[model samples]
Structure formats: structure tokens, C-alpha cells
Target: MKQLTLAGAIAAVCGTTFSSTAVLAQPSAQAADQSEIMELIVTGSRSPERLDEVTASVTVVDAEALQQDLQLTAELQNILSFRVPGLAPTTNSTSNFGQTLRGRTTLVMIDGVPQSTPLRNGALDVRTIDPAALQRVEVVKGATSIYGNGAAGGIINYITRQAGEDAFNVSLTQQVGMNAEETDDTASFRSSATIDGTVERFSYVFNATVDDNGVQRDAEGDIIGQALYGLSGVRTQSLFAKLGYQIDDDKSLSFTANYYDAEQVDRLIDVTSSINDGTKTYAVKPAPGQTFPGEPQGVDGNSNFVLQYRDAQLLSNTSLTVDAYTQEIENVFFYSTTFADPAAGFSGGNSVIVSEKEGLRLNLESVFDLSGVEATFIYGADVLNDVTSQPLADVRSWVPEMDMSNEALYLQSKFVIDDWVLKAGVRDESVDIDVPDYTTLRMCGANNVCRGGNPVEGGKLSYSDTTYNAGVRYNFSTAFSPFVSYSQGFDVSDLGLLLRAASVPDLDQVQTEASVIDHYELGVAGRYRALNYEFAIYESESELGTATVENPPGSGLYVPVRAPQEIEGWELALGLTVNESLELGTTYTYVEGQDPDTGAYIDARKIAPPKFTAWADYTVGNGLSASLQWMKVMNRNRFAPVDPVTGRYTGAEAPVEGYDVFNLSALYSRDNWRVSLGFENLFNEAYFPARAQAFTYAGYNTMGLGRTVKAGLTVEF
Candidate 1:
């Protein structure tokens, strides 16, 4: 059987041959109305290809879906939890703890620019950018080495908005909402404005947004604490701009800059009672000090700058692109008196971590015709430097400055013949890290318990690896396309954490080895009549699985644990358009992992229980639309019970109960104006998410939000 190229697959599915340029240039929201079968170009892939053409399992969330009344949220995690089947549930907090993709850490990017700080794993990358500034999100589900290190699980690329063909376009949106149970200080406000246009051979886009949230409340109408790094009572602002100039029909240059800032206002301290009998309760009161009960606790800042040049016709059949970028990030944690260590020069103060990165990327794509076969060749190289460090608010070093440099070269080729498509790629990656010796900080105070740090050794380390992938996909028919693929990825251990806790006298004596993960997958996707569906099963394995574990027992310090492990999972999604005004959809996901040697669920921290989501959308006459969504999480009993006092798991394992929630949204549009209303937790159910029940001691047991109402309006000109 002959396989079809992605373009041919799209033509088969849609019964039309779409212009690649036209499809790629159209906005996702507008494109959705033009075709029943989505044919958006995949951005995560180095080469131009449609979603169905690739042999990997991929999902695309378009602009319309992102702006849906029920899907809009300040936190990106919440949006992904419901849309991406394999992704773990959101923690409902500012921090994205335990939120893994395919049961592994995922690499996040913006327009092909890396956003993850792999050296520290701060888990803050997802919130670095506001969703309002993005036009679409592309998710590549599986291990891939084409983009270099840190993509062991997959990659998420956020494509920013672009200038329209109009001479000038302006848009403004405003939203205001409050907790239905307690409307006092629980109100929130958000607003965004954008201006974009294309004039002659130049194009430009600029957007700005601001948001302020009041205290969050549970079903009981109690103020939610700042525990678990909650997002309540926070203020955020963002600015984004892009400018492009066309030198000719085949050549262009562009520049982009973005900035984001967020800070938590501490209005009340968390006085939540400890977990008892597998249950925990939360309460809040004014702080003892004169400082605002909601003084700033967590402060985050992110800035990015990029310059790019592209030539679509560098030669007769070749194209080239070059990009240079720089990124700066700063994260500050809340001040803590209870956890303060006087010995560590801490008198109830906070800590801050900063990371800076600069990189240059180059790529050349070429097409060739061999006899009757067509092939596309993509080759690229990357060079990057990153420096990261952690320091106390008082200017004392916690983690010494670490400098890292990475260099990589990769090539990928896609072949098409008849209705068959085949792809193969390989990457060579090299990394170097340098650390300077410094005295460890004293962490214990006279009255407080402290975890001591390791003092000796500073040296340099180097690592290199070659990873590859291959896949085959057969079109068969647009209604029944199936594919299989195998790929590998490599990840270096969190060097900053390892170096900070190093006790060895010499850096060379330390055991630091990169872990290589292998992924295998089989999937099929199709569209028949008014229905579209996809199903996939995959297995990922690593001889040495990496996990963070408490070290020195009771020291309150953590170190990485490596063991043989394997993870397997499956995902399914189905959508049906009953008519022009009605649509229905559902998604199911299940995953499990274990350590072979220990015979234990080693990925308990990352794995999510089986989940099912269903939704219905109905459009009424007079430009009104309504939607209802339901999500149910199944029970999971993987970990043994834990002693509350010792914070250690007991021998007895107990099952974590399941829960369900419902949401409703309505939108009305007329002329150039749109109004929307959304109700979350429509039933006002008082249930705990899986994370809260499983990790009770970690403050994950915080009660879910009660019924909340959001209303917004948008104007376009």
C-alpha cells in the first residue's frame, strides 16, 4: 500500500486541495468555519506538514476554542487539563506541580523559542505568557529529538497572534466576575487591547492586558489561603509586540518583544488545619504583623526579545531561516516565618531565583524530486547559553551560579509516494556545564530546625548524545488513516539542584549521567460524515527513571532518585457535529507507570487517574450560543497511607475517591460586539481534586472553588 503526504491526506479528508500558503496564512478562528476537517499546518514540526500527514499523535487548539467562554482562564494549566487528554489535572494553584504530559515533564515553547528552565525545573514555564496573546497552541505528543534536549515527553508550542491583511484593526475585551457564594471582595477584573495591521510591505501587531483577582472562596464561603501557592488575590500585566518587514516576495525580517509581571497580594494568611483522618480543612485571618494581610508573596517577571530573518526562495528549491533570541526570568517565593532557619541567615524572609538565556537557531529546508518520489529535507543547528542562580531576599546565595552551553545539529527527511508518507530524523547534541566552588549557607536557626547543605566541590562537566526517530503513515482513506512511530529523547539531570547538594570533594567524582527515554506509539485518526475521531496507544520507558525524593530522611531536603521504569497509556477523542447549530464531543485518557525492580507505582506523582470529559454546544437563533461541559475523574489507590505527623507513607494503602464537576457558558454576538457569561462549578459541588486527596500533606487538599460567575464583552473595529 502506498502512503499519502500530509497535503494529500488533507485533500482526501476535506475533498478539496487547499493552497498550502492560504491555509497557513489564515487565522485559526476563520479557518474553522471554512472546512469541516481541520487542516492547520503543524508548527512544532521543523518542516511544513499537516496534522494528519505526520506519524505522531498531535493535537491543535485553535483561537476560537481558546476564546470560548468556558475555556477562558488566567491560568493556562486549567485550559489544558480539559483539552489535552494525556495531560495531568491542574493543581488549581499558581504552581504547576505534578502537571505532566504523558506522565513526563514536557518542554514548553513560544514560536520555537524554549521557555522551560530545565536546569532548575521550577515548574513555572506554563504561566510565563498570558493566553490572550496567543493565536493557537500545538501539542506534539511523544518523545522527539528534532528540537534537541528536554523534550522527553513532548513539546507545546504557543503561536502568537499575527497582523491581519487589513490596513488597520483594533480589538478590546473586558471581563468582570465574582464568587457567587461570596461577592464581597471576591470580585475579579480583566481587560485586554490589541492593534494590528499590514501596510504595504510591513506588518505589525501589539497587545496589552491587565488582570486583578480578589480573594478566592470555597463552597463554604471561607477565604482560600495562600497554601499550595494559590493564585488568589493576584495582579498580572503583560505587553507584547511584533514588527515585520518584507524585503521581497521571498525574503522577510521580523522582531518580537514580550514582557510579563505577576505578584500575589497577601490579604490573609493560611491557617489551615493539618490533615486528619485523610481530611483537611482551611481557614484564613488577618496577619499578625502590620503588613497588608495580602502583602506580595510571589512575584514573577519574564521578558523575551527575538529577531528573525527568512528567505523562502534562497535557491530554486530551498529556503533558509535564522533566529536570535534572549530571555530573562525571575521568580520569588512567599516569605515564611515558620520555615525560616536563622542559621541560614533567614529571619522570616523570602527567596528568589533568576535565569537568563540567549540562543541562535538556523535552519534550511529543501525539496527534491527523485524519479517519481517527492522528498522534503530539513536541516538545522542551534547554539544556546544559559545562566541561573538562587539567592535569599537578603542577598545570600542559596544555589551558586551555574553556566551551561548547548550545541546541536539535526536533519529530517520526509518522503511521499502515491498515498504513503515516511519520515526519519536524527540529532547530535552536546552540552557543557560550569560551576564555581562556594561555601554552603548555614540553614538552621537557634529555635528552628534546618536542613544543612553540602559544602565541597566545584568543577565542569560535559555530555553528548545522538538521538533518532522514524515513522510510517498510510492514508488508506481520509476516513481511516493509521500510523506507527518510534523515537528517543535525552535529558540531563537537574544540574543546579545536584551541584547545590553535592558533598563530594571534586565535581568529577559526582555521578551525573543523562537519561535516555524511548517512546513507541500506534495511532489512527479519521473523519466520516459528521463525526471525527482519533485513538492512540503508547509506551515510554527509561532504564533510569528520575524522580525527586526526600533525602536524609526528615531533613526536608530533596534529591533525585533513578530506577528502571516504564509507562503506558492510551488516549481517545471523538467529536460529532449534529447539524449547523449543534456539536458534541468527548475525551478519555488512562495512564499507569511502575518501577520494574521495586514493583511499585513509581510515577504516582506524575500519573493522573482515568478521566472522561463530555461537552455539548448548541447555537440558537439571533446569534446566541450555549455550552455545557462535564468532567469525571475515576478513583485511584496507588500509594499507601501516610502518617500525618511523620509525613511518611504507612504500610496500608487506601484508595482516593473520585469527583465530578460541571460548567456552563453562553455567548451572544451581534454586529461588531460580543457578550459572554460563564458559570463554573455550576452544581456547587464540594469535592477534592485527585491531587488534594493523594498528597494531603503537601496542601494539595485545598478545597475546589465554589460556584463562580464571569461576564465579559468584546468590541472589534
Candidate 2:
């Protein structure tokens, strides 16, 4: 079965590349000579405006662009890999992980709401929403306006689809493909419709959609290892709705809602599972494991689960324009592992984990005109709540526990002066955390070895601080502008405190605290004639954070510790219109980070290597087009064995080599019908990530997937 899947994937990739090569040979003069108009809707702002007039950096990914790229192998983290400079996916050893922006301090938002949770985990899954349901994606690369807390790096806003200004319409799309590996197959189906009209004093528009997606695989017909979840075959289902009305000639009201549900079943891997009894070994199905508070034997866990999220927005403009929404998340995770001896200790129970989160946000903005100057003022407040619980006699023990609530209020203003734009904003944020005096679990003792501790007397720890930012932009011409900005970000450190308690002498001083980050940047952006470009240099410093080791220490259970770091990087992007039918674009990034005092390079497992990416596309008459893209990542130095006596990653590995990949894509479109084909990793370059120690006990590193291909079609009316 796996072999058949692998064969299909290989055939798909080769078929698409060969089938489209000839169609790409011709260029249409008419197609190359046309000019594009500027009518983009501004995001990260309380008002609407053209893209060029906006004061912040923005990257817009249109729907057509998403549909044309058939390979779709890359997730959100991978899309940003080559498309944006200075941002890379995280490559840690933990399960279900994601990348960060600008070393640290970036935020993820779904239609303006925070997607990251303080208690549940880190950020939300980047792949939760399908591009099929998106009108566009707007990325604001810096810390600016504060809606919710936790956005220290930057912000990513995914704008959902809405009803266009037209009569009733409907659209449908389907995609399927395979890779060079065996048993790998993927498929997806999506449909959407909208209706708009006016009756009497009211004009309304309504839109809705349904989406389902498949999965991808490796060359050997086995599921490839994802940095987040091991193995593969995860599916998702989503439904969306939006409504709008005209209140008056110059005023309007709009509402949007989205309900998303996704899940994945348990997938067994050959390498991670082991069946051994000291002198004897066997290959067999192992029992699932669970996490109990106090138990040493048995296996108990579940792999089936689902996540549901909903968001709603209401807006109006007159005296004050307000936007509000609420979100909730609930999930269950089950599993266990054998830590010490595999023979006598072969039986360890599984853990049942449950998490819940909810958040609310409200914002109001007003615009005023004074003489010849224009000023926009914005203010808002947000509240966040998180709860966690687990029940068991062993690893799945629950005594019913929860975290405290967090609240913040912020205000910002932007002033336009002749050819210069100035802006500043500040937020007052506070956190309240609750905990017991001591855990009932036995302490490791004076020997420095410990298990769970006594339950602590329940109490609340709260603190508040002010974070602000100031920026200025000078317009050199109607198409060019240079800007400089400095921003301060602050986030509560309860997670940091939890990790620090593992090694600290006193856990009381380890109460919830705050960490601050200072970011500085200078850049220029503009469009001249047929060329658009942006260049930026940035540096960010953090006061308190930590480099945690997820695995257990040899004898003593040493958790993570707090440390300071300084990160700096530069980003460059260029887009050129080579006539009307041809376009050329490229993005490049360079980064360096380290401890300020020691000057030691940061660990490799945390950051992406320096990389460069470029792409070119040519269009022929009718509906045929072709494109080629190149991506390369530099070799990275990582942690390896320093000495046989001490088991530690003190120095660097022998420099794991990097790789260069090439991809080709072609498309055909006519009126309301379109078809796309794509070939990825055409040359089948071989490479390896630094190292990961998640499912397995060894510090094993996995190889990247090789060649792959995909094809799809869409019809709209």
C-alpha cells in the first residue's frame, strides 16, 4: 500500500512539470503591457485606505495567488520561510511546535483576535484555516497597535472572504496529489456562495463556505515527521459566515463569524516504538501511555481529538467605531513514555490532558481633521482567561486547577504632517496567576532528585506595566518613503517561572513576573514605475527569557533557566514587472543572535539558517502561465557531544549541510474555470534538520522530504 502511494506521488510531480513545460514557452505582449491598479484594503488599522498611504510594513497574499500554487506542501511557517525575510520556523525537540518572528516577540491574530494562549501552549496552529476561505493575508512586521497582549515580535492577520458587490454567486474547488514516497495521497474539497441586494432602507450581503482537506507523505510511503506532530494524516473542517448592512449614506454596520473544527487520529511510527525485555527483544504493538500524578505502572492514553473555535465581529462608524469578538478552545491529549529501564520498567501508564481557553477584545477609534493636519486616535481594552485540568491516580491526576485572568487597556495616535507620518501608542497590562502553597506529591528531597511536590496554598500573583512605541516616516516621493521606529513589548512570564522553579531554591519568589523587549528598526519602502521594493534592518533585545531543555537530565531533573539575548537581522524584497505578462520577485534574509555578555552564538535548534529565495513567472495569451522558484538555506552549527564522560550538548556539530530546491508550476484559466499543476523539489536534494528528541529517547535527526507534485481545478460563477 505504501509503495503504491509513493509511486503515485512521484508520477504526479513528473507529470505536471512535463505537461506544462511547453505551454510556458510563449509570452503574450498584451498580457505583459497591462498596468495594475492600487485599491488594497488597509489592515492593522481602524480605518480603510490604500496600501501606499499606510504607515506600516505590509505583505499581501491574494486569493488567486494561493490558488495558482498547486504544491501547497508548505504550511504557514513554510510559506513565510522564503516569502518573508528574517522569519523562520522553530525546529525544537518538542511535539506540536511552531516558528517565531524576529527571534522572539511576534503575535498571531485571526481576523484581529489573538490566537496564542498563555496556559494551553504557545501560539495556535498556523495551518488551522485554509487559504481557500481567505480573501487575503496582511502581515504587519513590527510591534505597533495593541489589540490583545503577547504580540512582541509582529502580527499576522488573515482576512476572511466576504460577499463581493455583485448578484448571487457560487464557487467550488478540488485538489489531489501524491509524492515520490509510497502510500502518500492528499485531497481537498471546498464550496462557497454569496448573495447581496437592497430592500427599502436596508442593504445586506451574506457569505458562507465549507472546506475539507487531505494529507501528504514521504518517499518511502511513510508519513514524514512534522516538527509539531509526528507522523501525518490530520484533517480539518470549517464553516464561515459574514453579514453587512448600510445604515446611512456615510455610515455602515458589518458582522462576521467563523466556526472551525479539526482533528487527527493516532499514527504509529516504526522507529519511535520499542519492544524489549533486557536480553530479549520483540517487534510488536506497544500499549498507549498516560500521565498520572503518582503511578509507576500500566499504559493508558487516547489519540482521537478535535479543536473548535469561533469568532464574531460587529462594527459601525459615526461618533465611534467599535470592533469586538470572543474565542474559546477545548482539547484532550493522551499518551505516555518509559523513561528509565526498558525491562522491569517497561510498564508506565499514560496521561490524560485537558486544556481550555477564552478571550475577549473591544476597540474604538475616531478620526478628526484639524486645519491642514489629520490625526487618527484609537483606544481599546481586552480580557483573557485560561483554565487547565487533569484527573488520575497516576499521570492523569486532576485536583481541578486554573490560572488567573489578565486585563489591559491601550491607546494610540497617528498624525500626518505634510510628507511625514508620526505615530505612538501605549498599553497598561496586568496578569493575575493562582497557585497552591505546596503539591501533595513527594519532593525529590535533599539529594537534589525530585518528583511532584506538595500542593501549594492557593494564592494570586498580579503585576502591571506600561509598554509603548514611537515611529516616524518621511515621504520622499509619491511612491517612496523611509521610516524609523522603536517599540517596547512586555509579556507575563508565568511559564518562565514554572520552569525556573525546577532548579530554584525558593518557589515563592518565582511568582508570575513580566519580561520586556525593546525593538529598533529603520527601513524604506515604495513603488517606482514598474518596480516595488522594501529594505529593513532591525535589532531586538530581551531582558528575561530562557533556553529550555525539554528532555530529562541524567540524574537530576534540571528544568529550564532564564537568560538574556540580543537578536539582529535585515530583510530585503524586490518585485519587478518585466512588461505586462512577466513578473520577477525575490526575498533575502540574514540573521545573528547571541548572549550579550558571553557572546556565544545561540543554539542552532531554535533558529532558521540564513536563506535566499527567488521566483519568476511568465504568462501566455488565453489562460496559460508558468513559474519557477529557487530556495536555499545555509548550513547551521548545532549542539553535539562534548565529551564521553559528560552527556551534554556543549559545542557544535560537524556542520550539517544545507540544501537548494527548485519548483515549477503551471496554470490554465478561462472566465470562471481554472486548473493548476505543480512540481516540488524537482531535483530531490537531500538534507537534514539539526536534531530533535521528541518521540524517541535518542537525539535523532530526521531527513527532509524529497520530490513531490500536485494538481487542482476550480470553477466560479
lDDT of 1: 0.73
Count backbone overlaps in model 2: 55
Stretches of candidate 1 off by over 4 Å are: 1-38, 69-72, 273-277, 281-283, 287-289, 292-295, 337-339, 343-345, 445-453, 552-554, 642-655
lDDT of 2 by residue, 169-196 (tens): 5566666655654433444434444445
Query: Residue 20 lDDT in model 1?
Result: 13
Q: Please give the lDDT score for candidate 2.
A: 0.51
lDDT of 1 by residue, 1-717 (tens): 112232244334423111111111111222223234446555545656766565466667777778883334667777777777787776677776677888888888888888887887777777778888898777777778877777877887888898999989998999988999888788899999999999999999999999887787887787665755777888889999999999999999999998988888645666654343455556476646645411264547788999999999999999999999999988776665533656544565565678899999999999999998898888999999989887666676767887989999998878887767777778899998888877555566445655545666787888899987776777777577776677778888766666566666777765578888877776776667776777777778788775666555334355667786678888888777789888888888888888867778854467778888888888897989888888888888777545556554521123457888888889999999999999888888887766666664534467788888889999999
* Most TM-score-accurate candidate: 1
Q: Please report how far candidate 1 places residue 59 from its true position, in Å.
A: 1.1
TM-score of 1: 0.92
Q: After superposition, how far is residue 709 of candidate 1 from its true place, in Å?
A: 0.5
